[model samples]
Target chain A: MSVTSLDPVRSELLAELQQKVERIQSGPTAEPVATHPALSGLLQLRAGGVYGVDAASAALLLAAGPSLAGAWCGIVGVQDLGVEAAQTYGLQLERTIVVPEPRERWLEVVAALADVVDLVLVRPPGPVRQGEAARLAARLRKRGAVLVAWGEWPRCDARLTVAGTRWEGLEQGHGRLKARRVRLEVRRGAAPPRERELWLPAADLAVRPVEAEQVRRVEAVPDPVRVVS
Target chain B: MSVSPPLRTMTVWCPDWPVMAALEELRPDAPVAVLENNVVLACSPAARVDGVRRGMRRRDAQARCPELVLAPSRPDADARAFDAVLEAVEELSPGVAPLRPGLCALRVPTRFYGGEAEAAAVIAERIVSLGVWDVRLGVADGLFAAEQAARRAAPQDVVVVPTGGSGDFLADLPVEVLDDPELVSLLRRLGLSSLGAFARLPQSDVHTRFGTHGALLHRLASGGDPHPISRRQPPPELVAALALEPPLSLVEPIAFSLRTTAERFVADLAGHGLVCTAVRIEADVDGVVSSSRRWAHPRWFGTADLVDRVRWQLTAQPAHGPVEAVRLVPEVVEPLGDHADALFGPGADEQVERGVARVQSLVGHDGVVAPSVQGGRGPASRRALVTWGERADGVRPAARPWPGQVPAPAPATVYREPFPALVVGAEDQVVGVDGRGGISCPPARFRAQQGDPWQRVAAWAGPWPVDEQWWDEAAARRVARFQVVGVDGSAWLMVVENGQWWTEARYD
Candidate 1:
């Protein structure tokens, strides 16, 4: 498929803006969307802003807490998302909506989903124009819904990128993939960046702050680090 | 005030309602019979035309009409199908008293529509338009007489007895119409053939012979009302209403405007030391209630919970026009002391409750679900997902002893769809479990697919057999589950049923 295929569908943002422009009053003080209790202070997401996560694993880690807390999460345009892995990371599958393909109506689909879901995770079908991106942000603000982009997004409340990760449970080329420890770097809008180590896919369906001893043991393994890092 | 005369009633009756309800999907004129306890309880008009009648044996009815369709009698189905008819009649008049699945009665407003006959005609027109062609209407001085009058009316017709003619009208009817077959038989044996003959006997003599039951029957025979209709007081309007000038249709904006009203309503109830558990949300458009539904909360409703209910109602119900007003009425409430918050610190439960409520607003109601354990043989069947804030009443109880269910310490995550896998022996040949509850070989390795590298089994448990529904040929199943732990320490629940291997759940 061509990357620049265009469909003649009208932008929902354009249609919504054409009507009487009454500002929708957001409830409360726009508290950040909840993250895992272990990473509560490390990550925050406000409405109308795009948040970035490094890998699909990191995104799933970020999504689990809010989902279990009763927030609905939607995954769009990312076909290879491992839902089984996501469940192990603490996601409530029953409350999750997976639309692996949004096609050309990506913007409209995301906006309509924003009206219903608390968080939307999207890897855009293709490059998004600046104007269309702005309109999408506005809708998110009006709806008090957060957007977590897998790839690059223009304006974001905070951007999180995983620096490195190490997997456990595998020994001497045997055993299955079980859990992983990850070092994540958080960059908030112009604020000084910060870093934290966490168990991204905790085997017990919980993400926790990585212990110093465990980090050291994982770092001591030079052979697997070269292969994974 | 002067002594008021007994109120007259108008009854709408549908014959063989249960049979009709069961045969609703069939052709309207199809010949169908409803059987109860091996006897024909009711039959369609087409079946009746072919000599099938009530009280006949099922075999006799079928023999009389070879094309007769037998439908199992279901009172619940009849009641559900009759709801639409009741709603239609309620639109015309409000005092609808459901006598049974097939019959309902309401007050006769003789003065409003000029006379009893005209009111009955209007009601008949409304019901007929709803596709119930077998509807019959009857108007008389009392409910008992009105019901009898309705039975006398032909299909799609009405019967109206004059104001004081109930006694004369009921006089000639056979005692069989009393509906007590044994009493009718006894009266017939005693030489009382008609209601008029039974009514002529002294009331004291009847009481002496049959007690209150017989006296009540005698009163009905004489056209005296068996049960007097008592006036019912109107319910108090506890709803809080907010009128919108331009009327809002969008859920967010409407929800925004409703926040204050909902909060204030909650506050008012809280002030009275009460908390609402169920609330009725109503939206009006063009001066008529466009939508109204009662939503029940799992626990007491907070301000945010109330607002979420209003939004959920708006989104679920497609309104006819822009909403002109919204109202919230507390349907069920409890004392605040019973649900008082902790004084020292915020309760974890209260926090979770608030978070769930907030999330319910962000997502639709179906967007949030809570996992519950249920009794079943399979991993997926043992788990039940309940929508947040809904009662988990219908799920099977987990306390029942499941004969072959996997032992406790259930997997943390169960795959919604089991993953197909292949379990192979040391030779890499596919292993199998035979019909004699024997493993063909000791499995040593497994893989989800051919290209994927096989994982060696570190430890394994028995392939406990589960043979269910063996008596039901079509639904019978023979499966065995094995808990296999890979060298990596990741355990899986694998099932081998009918020579197919599938991964049911993953344990971490």
Candidate 2:
């Protein structure tokens, strides 16, 4: 009701809001998430390293991180694992494009995927020539979609590499046994990505940190009955 | 009555009675006896010679005959085969009803077959042609009197009961012609062993013992009611198909195929002037099959309606993929008049066909259906939603009356496949063990996917137990079922026994 005078509670609230505004202005701004130019486009992969691509990691990056819902993605692989994982994650996968023997029809499958799908996840056939990889990358870029290559890429705007390491000491069973774990090294854009050591649980698709009791083994002892007689 | 011709009834008796000599056919070198309805209905005269009387046990007949030919009575088979003999006799008389395997009652117009004696001769000739081993023809004013007269006649004789004289003719015959053992016993007890004495009894007492049957007996004894002859037409043929490929994932292809087949089938029926009134579609998956809705359309057969029936069939099919094929068939057809059009207006059938095709494409072949009547003794058996072409015979009477069964009114929707159940605390040992080291109570908790956590049992009923059918040996299951409510507002039908617990069903 008072026009000119600021109450103590209102003044305090204003002071708190101003500090938050200043803090936001001084902090680093997050990068904008990339968007596909078309609702449906294809992602193509060159031979070799593309075939060994990690479909789960690519799916997580596309789905769980930024664009969560209604994001359509396609995975093309010689093996079924990548396509299957993508399906389990609930991505709308059109079809898996398989390159038959003689390998001449590989290009046709890639073209079909490009015409129908928005994002194409590709596992290429073995290794590819630098020219071939670069050509495919260019085609994907023209489609206005990013290609997150897993294994090896001859030419690409950004690259992420993964290295595996053995982990020691982890709990197993009903917390009654010991086991070893695995550590992974992630590299991104010419810089080494963070290296994280994690335990692999007995459950499917579950990864956890190694616990102390897992690596220990129990020993057997001899029976002690006959000495008394 | 004076102008109308008299009705003549005739009966033929086997003469040589080769059925008597055929006893050796059943048993090697053994005398055989024939029995009907578990009475000594007939005996090989050879068996009669061996001291096996008409009322002897099969064992005694065998003992008396030494080597006895035994034949199990097949009343239905005998009656069916006897129809050929009746058909031959009908050439001489329009009215013929076979009263027994070896007996027939015929009503022939006197002018049609010359006269009563000529008609009798013609019937006797036809009976002889049937390879009956012997023949006797008796013509009378009515059926019962004629049958008794024929039985008393010689192997080749013709006996006739005069018009308006059947009552006098039947007076001296034995009381067994009534075919009632109780009546015969009562007559024997009353010292009225002959038809004449039984007919003399007051109608009131006869009716008192047997009600209407006794009255009918009295009338028959007095040669009263005329035997009305009724003929039954043959049952119609049923033609159905089974699809080789189960339309599990694709409905469009199945629907298209079904519509085309149905149209072609209906077109084939055009010559018969018959239009199908009801069509059933059966969708078969693995070993289990589901029927589609039965369609009863007023317009007879329409391609669009047929396609819709198929679409309903496919939609009703279980979502699981094991279906091998779908079969569409019209169950009932009625004659269509010439006024009915051959086909419906253009685009009408097509629109319905397209809609069905679309539904089949979205669902499976079994999803589309029409309502059908299922036959069974119980409430669940009366009606079913069967596929358009499926046989609606799945209505099975419940094994026992389950007044409070889980499916009261039966669920309109049941999952095609039973979902896998997860058991909690199922492996835990019971606190107190029985002498045999088995747990007396089942596990305390159970859970399903994304369902609430285990809750303590609140109010519960059963372990109303069921044991596997031991006689079957193969299908016996030792299961104790209980209904429990969990803490998280879930009701489950659980079964535990023989060291394991399983959630049988859920009320969600």
Candidate 3:
């Protein structure tokens, strides 16, 4: 039968199902979210998998791309988050949901939010059991939502950790804090961790790959000073 | 013969009805004045004793009655209170015409009740039984003359104008009764002090000067008040109620029983070409209101949405006893044609709303919230959270320039409550900054938090002074903040207030 002959509702439903079947055959159950420019070569966030980060800023950075691209986001269990920092990182506050204290309903909240939002960032209060995490993982796959866990989660598809750091533009008592340089290490399934140095957030509050010249300039300062008496 | 005669009408009047409605919020005997646009619309009888009158300026009324309690005028409340009175009268005599809140008219039931006065007595008795004590009735040949007669009737009494006597009855009344202020003032200035004088003017002259409105008033003054009553059709039964005969206590079964009522409620609204966006859900136990709340939606509500809201309300706070009854009342409704999505069908917003509703049900009403950045100097103070689906209002503007705010590249993790930390100078002495921002000694090594091991600070900055709300001793704070980098590259924002240190936030 011709597509024009089908009722509008049936045609729309068929179109949605067709897209899903095509996605399954294409090897990924869900599509990838928008990735930050600095992380273009380093990471691609895929739906149905958990991404782990050691620090809160890394988690915000990971969620920022999809949020800026107009996808709704939810943040759970990270209390008193620096809202100014989140905005600077490109997370649209208007579309963000924050569940500061989920307490006992931690799993239930994330599962419910995953059914709607394209990305959800959660910080669990305690250690997770294998069975519960697997159950949540299955829910994520069914809903095609990405989960970014700030803390621990078993069987994570990838883990991003901030390995090293350096701060510039400060003396014993004179100048103020200006910029930071972080060495990021990415670990994926059964592969050696890849290390990269980048300006996690430069002076302008922009995250990008650090240059060789800027690294030397930061190291130029000779020593940690003692306040001259 | 071309113009039909006016019907015999009975007007029921409630004196100072607006003031009576305002009394619901105040003591019964207190002198109250209802004001609209700074002008007194009505005053209680107690205030009238002190010379408070209608149309008095706010200041003038206050001058007359120093102890006057002012109430904001609400016409909707007045109309709502009057609805019960209209319904009572309608039970005795159908085809009632509502002139306004506090007053109504209907065709007199002369034959069935034996006489006009007896009909008036029956209606007045019915109204008095409904708790309205100050009601009077009047019978006449036309709407205007009947209303005027009702005003003259004593409380709980009936005033009947004899047939063809409306003209003589109205001749002696003052011209001020004409409802229009501008035209009445003009007539008063022309020395037409009584309705008789205004009615004596040539009808053609009144028409040429006052146009249609003046001619109509002239007709009223002449006893041939041409205005006819158009009776109001009773409002449709829109409230849907269900009785749980055995009184089910569980939320699910109660929700199940209420599904039909909810569906009927939506269908009823749709039958009238309306969609309810906000609804008031009430559950009763043993004839007492146990739970009541008004749930609002960002978009129009459907059958399933109403069910979910009812279920959530019950789950959040269960009634003290088993629920015996449930009701759904539409609060805010709009025309169905206003749906912006008619072309594309239901959008993703409805789906998102359903998901959020599930989360709200799990954690209780205030569990899920939408966040936005607001103006403040501290990280915690900058974030405002409104319950999801609620419009964010009264939040501080983020566009203001908040001086002394921590510079850009704000920390990623802000502690909801600042945690105690130790920042020591040389020789492990705790660091302190004097009131003048002079550091006693430089911080050499510090612990980000108590449990974390001490590490040498590779780089450190200020005693940037933050002194706020000094006039309020309880809220006054004098603090010094510093950014310190650990050897491992973790950075922390710490504050030293009154010589005690606390970690405020962390930069990844």
Candidate 4:
């Protein structure tokens, strides 16, 4: 078929394929994750599970850098990100430029950064109203910048849905080493919810997925194969 | 039936004039005394208690306080320092005039400045706020009357001499207010105990006895002559001092302080539409002070010149210790005319000045110099060294010429010290001649411990010879100077004949 003659069918199929690819890419598939050690330890805890939604949002922002290059990324409805996650990512501590206090002069600070900064990672001062968020997003878009609105983004183009999970067989002990298991649930781009089990070792963030077949093999092996070769 | 009016003018006097002496003795900070002849130079309220009045002799003042810290007056220093005070006051009024060294007269039109009392109070408050809390302010219709009123006013008080009431005010004032001791004694002999009694004397009779002096006193006593309040112009010259805390080390802070002081000093000159030809910076290290090697530049001074002089003074400061304070005083001021061309042409910028200043600051002031030509027979004899950025102004006779000196069209560049030269051959002969038939000298073949290489001679000129200053053996050198054009097309003045070839100058 000539390139121009295949337009209609091609367009339809390409749109469908794009949707499928995005769904699959955004889904809960086993993927290697890089995280600093301190954050990995906190995530291993059972009580008061770490907010997976905020973490996933931050990760998305980091990945979408070229699109959101010089934008005001307002993170709202999330005090946990402001206090811990942002610092863990080295965003708050590594800044060499002027760090203005975030209070009455937050808008002024934004104005001052209009010419200088690339990405402004801000946690909003108050609740995120839909109208205010929309206005801010419009302004950011007009400025050719992206807005990675975290927490309660009112009218976002992309969203990462998170479900809580707990680790099993992990206990706080006096020994230097500890091991634990975790379950993750993620849904994105209209994909069905998926679950995965992973092992988190002390002092490391290498998440090794525990396969069902491997579990069966362990059960079948029986006491090191009856102590035979 | 008519009613008599109350007294409109009242004088407030300090009963304890010697309190200033007491304050000086009791408190370490008190070096205060009343300045009477010149309006209250300074006074400690303590001096008032012992009646050690302003203008009193040192002996009389001591008798009163017994332990008075009697500081001999420094009117000039006080006036220079008071420029800062006057500048601060200039913000209030444009017509401020110095009535005396320590006293300034500010004229405020009563209509615009509320009333006389309000104006006086405002001025008094401003004076007190200047950390001079013991000022006695007086307001009157004219300068003389106001001054008299101010003198009679108590410390920290404001006395107002009402208009049209000068005659009544003087009625009770002692005849001693006449200012002349002879006139006072004469008036006392005439049984005139008060100015009111003195004014009753006929002017003709007063003039006959005291001549012009008596006539003047009679007119003043009667308030017939209007006190001429001529505006006292600002000083023709300016001097400023900066007191640094914790002393200073790095040149940057000292330069910063100097920048501020120089700005003020220049601004003061600019106020009079004048400029300074010479600026003297005196740096006080500990208690000892060292003045700068006086530098004369153009009328208008740049920040670099000021900084350079300050740096020079500071660096040259004896090892007495770090400087505790610095005083930049402009000693000579000349009328600024329309001369735009810089002393060093426009090509010179602040950076060059700053660099020169930095060098002078690091090394001694005499270490950095500009080339000056002197009258002499030899190449070195005609050269004199002068501090950078200063004009030589006049030609100085050359001390003496070196024997066998090279003639005129002297080398364009002369090194202060001769660098060791390489000899091509043992005797006056050329060796190792290249294909071009050029002789390679030392530095070309022979190298110094540290320096650039010398090139071979090309088209060399004759060795012009002259011997001079043989009388002073310590300051004499016999050199056979020759001008040689190098293979690289660079002309140099080389000396030979003593079996040693020294590269003296270069003309590239």
TM-score leader: 3
True contacts kept of 4: 0.00
For residues B236-263, what per-residue lDDT tens digits would candidate 1 score against the true structure? 4457888988988788898898888988
User: What lDDT does the true structure give each of the candidates?
Assistant: 0.74, 0.50, 0.84, 0.48
Return the clash pairs for model 3, or none.
Answer: none
Query: What are the per-residue Cα lDDT tens digits for candidate 3 across B1-508?
Result: 5876546999999998989898877888899998988899999989999999999999999999999998877676688789999989989888998888999999998889999999999999999998888999999998888999999999999899998999999999999998889999999899999999999999999999999989999999999967778987655778889999999999999888888888899999999888887799999998999999998765678889988998999999899999999999887776776654544764455556656876787887678888888877766667688777765655679889988777767788788889999988878899888878888888888888876777788778888888777885667877888988866667888998878899998886
Predicted complex 4: CAPRI docking category: incorrect
TM-score of 3: 0.56
TM-scores for the candidates: 0.50, 0.34, 0.56, 0.32
Worst ten in a row by lDDT for model 3 chain B: B339-348
Q: Could you give candidate 1's fraction of true interface contacts? A: 0.00
Candidate 2 docks with a DockQ of: 0.01
Candidate 2 residue B473 Cα shift, in angstroms, is 33
- Can you tell me which runs of candidate 1 are displaced by over 4 Å? A1-30, A45-137, A143-229, B1-7, B13-83, B90-104, B108-129, B133-138, B143-373, B383-393, B399-429, B436-438, B441-464, B482-494, B501-508
lDDT of 3 at B491: 81
Candidate 3, DockQ to 2 decimals?
0.33
CAPRI grade, predicted model 3: acceptable
Among these predictions, the greatest lDDT belongs to 3
* Ten residues in sequence with the least summed lDDT for candidate 2 chain B: B407-416
lDDT string for model 4 (B357-463, tens) is 43344444444444335666544545554445544534455445433434333333355566766534324343232333233442222221134453443344434
* Cα lDDT over the full model 1: 0.74
Residue range A105-182, candidate 4, lDDT tens digits: 443333223222333334445555777655554444333333333344444434433232222221221111123233
- Runs with alpha carbons beyond 4 Å of true place in candidate 3: A1-28, A212-229, B1-346, B390-394
True contacts kept of each: 0.00, 0.00, 0.70, 0.00
What order do you get sorting by TM-score, best first? 3, 1, 2, 4
TM-score-best of 2 and 4 = 2
